[model samples]
Target: MNCEFVIKEEGHLTQSENGPEVMYKEIKTEGDDDIKSETFPAGDPLAFEDTKLEMDQREEQEDGIYIPIQCSQTGENDFTCESLNDVSNKSFTRKPSDYTHSNEKPYKCSVCNKSFTQKGSLKMHLYLHSNERPFRCPFCIKSFIQKSHLNEHLRLHNNERPFKCSFCNKSYTTKSYFNIHFRLHSNEKPYKCFVCSKSFTQKSHLNEHLRLHNNERPFRCSVCSKSFTQKSHLNEHLRLHSNEKPFKCSACNKSFTTKSYLNIHFRLHSKDKPYKCSISSKSFTKKSHLNLHLRSHNNEKPFKCSVCN
Candidate 1:
C-alpha cells in the first residue's frame, strides 16, 4: 500500500495547490517501498512529529479520509478536508484542538435542517420547536430564551407607557390596546337606518330608536311570535304576554317586569320617600311619584299639551 502526505498553510486549508513547502527529511521504511513521506511547515516541532504519527496510523489502518473518529484519543491532528463529508458523518472530540465545524454538527434539526455549528445552537433551537422559554425574569417570572430578552422585559416594571398616540396624547404600554382606542375616533357608520335618514354608534341603539319610527318588531320569543326591537324589551314584553312576573316586591309580594319598578312598589308599602323633589319638600322614591305629588301644589302644568284647551 502506498500513502501520500499533503499539507497547506494555517489559513489556506481550503485552498488546493500542487503541494505545501516540503521537507527534505526522507525515511526509507522497512515494509513499504511505495510509501511517500510528506511534511507541512511547522512553527512548533512537536506538533509536526504528532502529525507524522497520525498520517502513519491512517496509512496502516487503510481507512478512508471520510471515516469519522473520536478525535480526543487521537490528540492534536491536522484535520483533512477529504475526511469530512457534509456534517452528519462525524463524531465530536473532547480535546481542545477538535474545534472543527465538520465534527461539531452531527445531528441536524428536521424542521429547518439548520446546522448549529455547535450542539448548543441545536439545543436552543429545540426550545423554538417546543415553545419553551426556560429562562425567566426574576422580578415578574416571565421566561425568555436569551438573557437580553429578559433584560428588555424588566423595563415594563416601571409603568413606563412609552408608545404614545399621535392624535390624543394618550399613552399605552401595548400597541394593541392603543389601536382599539383609535377606532373610537374614526366616524364609522356601522349602524344605518333602513327606513329613515338616521345613524347610530351601536346597532342595538339604532334598532331601539327605529322601533319608535317604524313600529316594527323583529325579535320574538320562541314560545310566542309577539315581537319587539330589543332582547331585554322582548323579555319584559313576554312577561306581559305570559303574565309571568319574576321580579317581586319583598314588602308586598306584588311582582313586576323590572326590579326598579318592584323597588318603587316596595316603597309604596312603607310610604318611605327616598327621592325628594328638587323644588318642594315632597319626597317619593319614583320620579313620577314625586312629580305627581308636586302637581297638587302647583295648578300650572308646563308639560301640558298645546292642542289641549
Candidate 2:
C-alpha cells in the first residue's frame, strides 16, 4: 500500500510495484499550491534522475494531464480529479535525464514564517525558536542549533583568528563583525551630520555630533536639571549633583568634575599664571577671575545693575 507523509529531509520513496516496474519522474512545483498527485516509478529509491520539471509556468494541459515539458522541483496534485484523468495527467514520458541539484523549497517555518528551500534549513530555524541548542562547543559552553554553528563558536574559545582585517592585524570570529569594524579604518565618511556639514564613520557618532551643533541636551542631570548632549556628559554632571567629586586636585584640596578639569585647576597652584588682566597689571590663577577683573578695569558693566539703573 502507498502511504503519503510530509516530505522532510529529501529522500527516496522506495516501493516494489505489483505490476510492471514503475519509473520515477521528478516534478516541478515551484508555484503550485496543491502538491501530491504527480508520481513516477523508478528502480531504486536513492537514484537521482533527470526530468524536465518546469516550475509553475504557462503550459498546455492535455485532457487535464499536465505534460512534463521541463524538469522542476515541484508539482500540483488534485485529489478531486477522476482516476482515468489522474492516470492520464500522471503518466511519465521517456527522455534523457540530466541529474542536477534543485533549489526548490518543500517546507516552511511556523514560528518566524520563514520559508526555506531545504528541510534542514527549516529544522535549524526551528531550533532557534525553541531555544534548543543540541550542538555545544567543547571549549566554551556556548550552544548552537547546528554543528556548523558550534564549530564557528569554538573559534573564539580556541583563539583561532580565521577572519583577518585588511587594514589592521586584528582578527574576528565572524566576517560580519569584521566587516562592520573595517569601516573604522577606511577614510570613508558615509554618515553625514544633518545639522552641520561634518561626517563620521558611524551613524551613532554622527548623531552625537549633531546634538552639539543644535544644542540638543536631552540627558539631564536629575539634581540640577542641567542637561548634556551625551549620556556620559550627563553622568559626569551627576557627580556635581551628588557632591561626589572623584577628580581631586593634587596641588590643592579642590575637587573637579573631570580629570581634564582637575589638570586645568592644578595650574592655579603654580606661579605660572599666564592669564593676566588685559587692562590692569593684576593677575589671577583662573581666566574667569582675570576676565571679571578686566571688566572692572574697563568700567564696563555688561551685567546691568537694574536696581541702580
Candidate 3:
C-alpha cells in the first residue's frame, strides 16, 4: 500500500517487489529530522532510471584519469580539467588585459618584495638573491644559476656550434647568440641610447656607449692608475705596465702585447702587403706607408715647417 524510500550513506536505494515495502530503516539522529521521507511506487521506472544515472556518474568520476585540457585563451597546454573546474568554481579566470588592470600577483618572493603571477617564475627569480649554484660546468670552474645556462656553457668547451644564421651561415654555440647575430643581417638595432639617440645591435654595446656619455671609466689600471671606459682597454694597458708580450709571432720569436702588432710583424716574414694606394696602385705592408704614398696624389702637406714660421 505505502512505500518509503530511504537514501543510504552509500547513496543507493534498496528495492522490494509487491505492496511497496520499506526496505531501508531511516536512522533518527539530531540532524536526521532534515531527511524528508518520500513515497514512490515499487516499479517506478523514472526513479530507477534517475538512480542508475547518478550511480553511473559517480563511478565514472571515481575511475576517471585526470585529463589535462589546454587553455584556449592563453595557448598554453599547462591548464588541466581539474584546474579548470577549480578555477570555474571560483570564477578566477580573467583576460590578459584584466591582469594588467587589476595588477594581480598571486605569487610573492619570500626574500624580496618582487611578485609574480606564476609560482615557477618566482622560484626561478629566487636564484638571483642566493649564491647557490649547483649546476657547474665540467670543463671549467664556472658555475651557473640554471641548468640551461650550464648546458649552454658546456657547448663552449665542446666547441659545439649547432645554431646557424640563415643569411651569412654564421654559427653560434647558443640560440640566444645566434638570434643576436641574425639581427646584424637584418640591421635591427633594438637598443637605442637615450641621450644621443644612437642605436646599437647589442645591449652591451649600448651600455659601453652610455659610459662614454657619462664619462664613467669604471675599469682602471692598478699599476698606472690610468682609467679606461672598457675592461679590454684596461687589460691592454696592464700589459704595457707589466711589459708582458703575450701575442707572439710564429715566424719570428718576437712577441707583442697586442694581436694587431703581431699581425703587422707577420707581414715582415711573409711579404703580404694588404694596404694599397688607390691612386698609385702600389701596395704596402703597413697602412702608414700606403697613406704616405697617397699624400703625393692629393699633394696634402700634413707636416708643416715650424722652422720657416
What lDDT does each candidate get? 0.54, 0.55, 0.62
Best by lDDT: 3
Error of 3 at 305 (Å): 6.7
Can you list the residue pairs that collide in candidate 1?
65-83
Off by over 4 Å in 3: 1-103, 106-112, 248-309
Reference-based TM-score of each model: 0.28, 0.32, 0.53
Task: Indicate the TM-score of model 3.
Answer: 0.53
Off by over 4 Å in 2: 1-104, 187-309
Ranking by lDDT: 3, 2, 1
How well is each residue in 157-270 modelled by candidate 2, as lDDT tens digits?
Answer: 787878898677889987766766888777778888766678887777788898888889899877778888899888877877677788887766788788767866777676
lDDT of 1: 0.54
Best-to-worst TM-score order: 3, 2, 1
